[model samples]
Target chain A: MHFHVEVRNLCKDYPGKRALIDVSFGVERGEIFALIGPNGAGKTTLLRILDLLDEPSSGTVLFRGAEVDYSIKDRKDLRRGIGMVFQRTVLFNMSTFDNVAYGLKVRGMSEREIREGVKAALELVRLQGFEGRNALALSGGEAQRVALAQALAIEPELLLLDEPTANLDPRNASIIEEVLSRVNREGKTTIIMSTHNVFQAENLAHRIALLNEGKIERIGAFQDIFERPHRFLSEFARLENVFSGFSKATPEGTSIIDVGNGLHIEAAFERSGSVIVHIPPEDIILSTRPIVSSARNTLEGLVVQISDLGSIVKLKVRSNRDFTAQITKRSFNDMKIGLNSKVFLAFKASSVKMI
Target chain B: MESPFIEEVLSITLLSLRVSGLAVLIGALAGVPIGTILGFKRFRGKRTLMRLMDVALRSFVNTLMGLPPVVVGLVVYLLLSSSGPLGPLRLLYTPTAMILTQLIMVTPIIIGVTMSAVGGVEESIREKALSLGASNWQATWMVLREARMGLLTAIIVAFGAAISEVGGIMMAGGNIRWFTRTLTTAIVTEVELGNFALAISLGIILLTMAFAINLLLTIMQLRGVRG
Candidate 1:
């Protein structure tokens, strides 16, 4: 498969700080590739470099197997094929129609064509009847949609979105995500978006690259990365029930880990010796009382802290080692669990995976 | 009712408006583009050498902004006086010489204010324009459009300065009655002759014209802001 863009050995340094260090990645043609990491992970920096809005301190960005020439004429020509939606929606101080028409006008499109293209693009984002409104007067969500329509009106070959829904409400975020997916599917536009939201990446991207501290820690399909994550990836993705312990093989072909403080976690994996273990937050069950169940590992712990994460409650339990478990708010109310409550955490052996 | 004094005031006022209006028109024609270019374009050594040049240029223009009109009159008088460098053309003590003096005074104001106005446009707007596939010229045009209010203010201010100035036009125009006598020079002539009533009447007319011009520009400015 021909790669749409190949970024090789990219490095960006700003005064006393390095934003991107030896970052290298290839974007497949017509695929939704996501750069996932926390804030200040150099996501914006990388996207800026890809968009040719910025030049890297040292690197070569190959567009369709051709190294980009960093000349004024060449860069302008290259930028014409790429559309970027900034983390902040930047709309021209004009009517929505004019903002959407700006790119086409710059490209020297005829007025009739500009009108048709803008109408279609606005319709794609479900922003019809908004053309006459001032772009600056719209709500945050509507403004963002207009920005997206502006980019799409150009019909660029590559779309680079830098946290398009960063400050948006859930409904607006979902709308943007749906539009992105539809654009990719219908227009076959190559997409590369940088997002701090892990769930959004998992939902939208066909492939994901986990970036941390200016480096790509791992890149793979969402299921594959989640199933067998690196230590840093698991931490960044908030698959946070991670532990380090020595493992010994059991007679049943399973391995038992002697976690510190007299805690033993059994896993179905065959790994032995020193290993990093990850337990998905949803896989662990929090109970008010010990239950006699078929699940292999059951540990007794005190609920040291409970954090309300919107629809769910994240409980930090202090067993032999600290373990974080996520439970529905309704479940928390039903179980009547709170701070300092003694609880039993149960998970099957297969739920514990070694990284 | 049809007094010669009133006729004299009308001619003086019309000549003053004509000279100053032409001066501002020419100044804006020359200054706005130069100011816009200086405001937006970045070149090598812009942070150091170009910045130093920018400071020097602004200092020069600002110094000229406050230039005493008599000193400008002296310079123009020497240049256009008979037996001077431009003596053969004999532009001295004429309406053309007065227009030239006022033009010199007004150009710096136009350039300084326009440069500041164009510079005040947000850098991000230019970047966004460029990212949207606009050429350098196109981006610049957009910035200028965004800064229209400041440009208009520059023109208004420069015109005001030109219309009210007396010393430069007095020396260059020679204040010949019925020919080169503008409102300002005429008021000076009347005051020197102890014609306080005529002087006061011309003063009122001058003040009214200034107010009328400012009121019109202010209305346009407010409309632009509302839009």
Candidate 2:
């Protein structure tokens, strides 16, 4: 099958740092492909190279199975078929109408066409009645919408967004995501976006590439990748409570892992030798006193730190191993948990996954 | 208003306005493009060029900004003198000579201010424009639009400098009555003649003209800022 876009052996090197290292990917026409990674993972650099805004140190980007020519004339022609929205919205210091109309105007579209296209694009972004407002004076969300409208006005064949909702409120973020979905569905504009939000990648992208340290760690459908993650991905996905230990299968078909400092964690699965373990923060129950329960692993530790994360409180417990737990602020206040408070953390054998 | 003195003041004021206005107009027409090009374009060795300009070109322009009007007048005088290279034009001691001298005086000011103004626009604006499908020339035009307020200020400032100058016009124009006697030179002549009252009156009128021109330009700048 002919892919819409193909990136092969792409590498970007700066003076003192490597931003992308031998990155390769493909996007099918009409599919939403997401590049998911943390900050400084070179997501923006890769997106820029795809958008034809920057050149790679060594690589080839093929569109419709044809390698792209980096000449100025060819790049300009290619760029007209691609639209990019930056992480930081860049709107001209003009009215919203003019901002949206700029792309069409530069392409030398007729006045009537420009007017109709700009109006329709703005309507798609749900920013109607904002035509006369100065784009520079717009609120953050409104400015981002205006930028999206500007890109959509040209009706590009491919849409590239670099964290379009990175700084938006939840309402605006959802609105942008909805608009992106609708545009992909209705226009069949192949969409590629970079986002650090794992949930967002799962929600919107038909396929996702987990990127780390300028490399593509894994790329597949969300369910396939998340369900049976690679060792590195398991550690990346379960960001808070990962541990290295040795596991041995017991006679009862259960596994016991020596996770340093004489602490052994019991797991439902049977495994052997050294393994990495993941315990979800939400699964670990915190209590002031030890309780006799069905949970296989009950470790005693001291609350080294407590951080109030708005509605939830994150506690760092240091026992034989360091574990992070998220609890409700109300439960934290009721229990009166403070720094250096003694606590017991409990979880079932099934909760511990050996990667 | 019917007095000879009133007629003399009116003629001198009109002549001054005419010479300085033409000089500023021509200077702006020449300097704006040069400044814009210097401000926006980047090529290989651009940094080296800028470093050279920073150390040499800018210092030269700044030095010209404080150039004594009389020295410029003397240069124009020699150029337009009968025995000089440009003597065939016979422009010496004419209002044209005075205008040329003023033009030279203000062109550097306009160029310097305009260059700085265009430079003040964020580089990202141009990059964003290019990414949005604007061609090189189109992107530059957008930058120029963004720097319009500064450009207007440059014109106003050059106009002020042109109109208030005395030495260049005095040497080049010869202060001929009813032809080339501008406000500043006329005021000097009046003061030398011990006509203190008339000199003071001419000074007031000159100040009023400067105020009016600046006020108009400032209003334009404010409107640009608001938009």
Candidate 3:
């Protein structure tokens, strides 16, 4: 059997944490493979290892039936054939044309070739006229599209992505998803991506690996992995900002859910007793300080994590419970929010959806 | 406009610029590379030693940045004295000695500031470059390019500190009337002699230089520097 990439008994230990343990998988050539898991479930670590950016503590990774030699001095040649986009958007402080042209320039391409390549890549991402715009000044969606252009400009044999659309607005997310599908179909590039969203996985992958707590819980078709464990896996793994608990209907024509851990979420729908609810990250707003708002849900949270997604900033705020919020990068800077800074999250009751 | 006093002031200002400018130029040439190395490299597989060395280097640079002007002057003066190790070169009590003194004083400022600039952009930029197929040297070059503005800030700050210094140049240059005199030492002399008008005028010239350079810096910042 011919396989594009295969791993056996991979393990990675960092200080007191074991990020991956004896994980084994094989990806066939020209197929979309996905690694789906919740937060802190080793998805990022596995992707990094696959990109050859990090070394496993033990195990062997074979690419194209040859074992990878991490100790080789010419790993540049090996890595040149692979492209990766990180979860947090990263771009050079340069014009979009220059940022997208970086990989080609590093490979000693001629000026004409680099220019043509950049134009084509940006056009692919629907950023035809953004060549002269400063990358840092672009909106979040545009900046992420620029990042995708940078990766696609390289035309790698393998593409790896970490949470590509997890924090994007719906339109931009769908655009990226469409681009991924087109690239896979047209270029026949082997793609590996890690995501916690079941909807995204179900929409893209031909094969799936469900990872949790440093190990693969299951690996197969989506339905094959979740056939029996559907309720348990979907509770926390399928969506962003998901909560489950007993809910009581209020006189204001809404439902208040006691999601435990000193938190109660208000939903627009009227439901009683056991229930599950989800709030899309894009539906929430973040502020450095609290303000009077008509929204039914207002919670003060501590900024635990901040991800710069070009024009937008995605923050993980630990309040009554962990909540994800998105805000414009300008507001994030204006508010001078930093890690551990107190902030507020306000979302309309209608923003919550029953799962 | 061609008065003797005005001619003297012009000469002093020219001397100050020549000496301090040369010193800062040499400092940048030497300090930028050192700062880049310090910013980008770590001793992998030896985390404890890496941290210890990092702390030691930071403390050393901080101490040098805060070193007394007179102390630097004394050290340079002694090194070029007749009986010292560098005595055979006979550079004592010359503009060269003042340049050396200012170079010692400002190189740490340049190194410290440049280190911070390069360090700020190092990790994310390097990883991004490497993941896009750049080699190690190419990745470091990318970080340095990204930090071009910070590097400019370093040069501006170092030049400001070097030009305004008096005690070090006074000791090393000996404030020779037509030979080694600079704007700062001349101002000190004018103030001691109660020439308030000349002293104030010289102060105005110093402020004007700082203001012009800082205006350039402000414009660069307003050009939309994100990091």
Candidate 4:
């Protein structure tokens, strides 16, 4: 398999801390890859390093099998094939057409080619008629599209996007995502983006790299990462029903006591000491009272926080052992769950994927 | 009492224009690079240099701004009056002396204002320019282009300051009638000679010049905002 972009043991250090530590990953051609992390997780730093805006302290990045050159003289040829959209969209206070055409102009494209290319790029971003408008006056989403158009006008083989949807409303965010998806589909560009929105990653990324504390804890297919995540990865992914407790033996063979509670939960692990449980938020069923069921695990907890992650409402249920569950907004509304509400959170034996 | 001599009023008015205008031109040529350097470069003693230039230039400007035209004239007179070193150049009592005096007076204002204008080009914008494949010189050019209107306004303000002041002209130019007497000096000489109509006409012309320069600056400020 030909990898369009390859990173080998990339490391970056700032004044007092390591921003990126030995991060290595590769993106196959025409794949959508994600670099997901929190604020200081070095997501943008890695993207910048790959884009050649910044240099790594050590290690190498290869584009299309060639070693990455950090020098401008050597990298200009490489840079010509890579386009980057910054976290904060920047467009010269000129017309959208000029903004999109600038890269082409700088690269010494003929005027006719620039015109055709810019038009096509703007059309791809669904900003066809806005060519005459001042780029500065465009809305957040529109401006982002203009930024994308500028990069697209160059027709780069690799596209690096840094938190492209962080600041937009959901509608605008979706618009950008759709535009990107179309671009990736049509141009077969090897696209890597950093996102705060987990759902956007789920929707767009062929493979997701979960970055935490400047380390790549997990990188896999989106479904694989979501379904069977590493312990820290599950937490970072904010998977529902992640709880840990000690295992104890009973007449039922083996069980675990969720420390905060006196009750025992069935154990799937034979050699369990301190074990962690990952129950998808959607898997947890909320009820007003005790129910007799073969589902095996039932924990009592108080609703601590309800966050609206677009389609899903994340219920932070704090039990004797802290547990989190992902529930639909409809489910949350049906339950009328509010902060400090006493609730019973239940999930089936098969639903709890222990890692 | 009857009105004083008209020629002195004309001469003083003429002297202010000639000296200050010449000073502004020279100051701008000198200050633009200094301001650009101070705004863009970060060295070990940059803050120190900035502070030193700030205190020194501001005090120098204020001193020159406050100095009486006769004192500047007397100083120029003393410097070129044969006894002084290199007085043989005979620069004293010449329009060039007046021009030199005003030029020194206005240099600081031009430097200070132009520095601020260049400084206003945001660092983020600078980085953005660099990321967009701009060379260091290209990035500097972008900053300077974006800050062009502000720089122009600084120049205009410097020009206005240079053209209306009277101190350097009377002392350095010696307010020679019909020859070295610019508007400011001419007005002074005319007022002293009780040439009220001529002095007032020259006053009107000086005020108009100042107004025109200020208007041009205001337009530039607006253009800076629009651009």
Candidate with maximal DockQ:
2
Say which candidate scores most in TM-score.
2
Q: Report the lDDT tens digits of candidate 4 across residue range A199-236.
A: 77887899999998899988988788777667776566
**Candidate 4 error regions (>4 Å):** A1-3, A71-78, A234-277, A281-349, B1-30, B41-99, B190-201
The candidates' DockQ values read 0.41, 0.50, 0.35, 0.24
Cα lDDT tens digits for candidate 2, A1-355: 8899999999999878899999999999999999888787889999888877778899889988989776654355678888889999888878999999999999999999999999999999999999999999999999999999988999988999999998787567777888898999999999999986555676689999988888998899988886644576654543667788899999999999998888899999998899888887778999999968999999899999765544467789999889988788799999999999999999999998766
lDDT of 3 by residue, A1-355 (tens): 8689998999999999999999999999889999988888899999888888788999989888989988875467888888898888999998999999999999999999999999999988899999888998998888888888898999988999999887788568777887888899999989999987666676789989988888998899976874444444755475557788899999988999999998888989998999877777778978776857988899998989876654566788998789988777788899899999998889999987776
Candidate 4 lDDT over residue span B1-227, tens digit each: 23454655555555555566667777888887777765663421436776787667546644544455456567777887779874999887777877776766667667667777887766655555555555566657767766787688768877876687676767777777655677876677778899898779777878886887688778867755534
Give the distance in Å from residue A108's predicted Cα in candidate 1 to where it truly belongs.
Answer: 2.4
Q: After superposition, which runs of candidate 3 have C-alpha atoms over 4 Å from their true positions? A: A230-232, A239-355, B1-8, B41-46, B216-227
Model 3 TM-score, 2 decimals: 0.78
Please give each candidate's TM-score: 0.79, 0.82, 0.78, 0.74
Report the CAPRI category for model 3: acceptable
Q: Which has the better TM-score: candidate 1, or candidate 4? A: 1
Chain A superposition TM-score per model: 0.74, 0.73, 0.69, 0.74
Each candidate: what lDDT? 0.86, 0.86, 0.85, 0.75
Model 2, residue A187: C-alpha shift (Å) = 1.3
Write the number of the candidate with greater DockQ, choosing between 2 and 3.
2
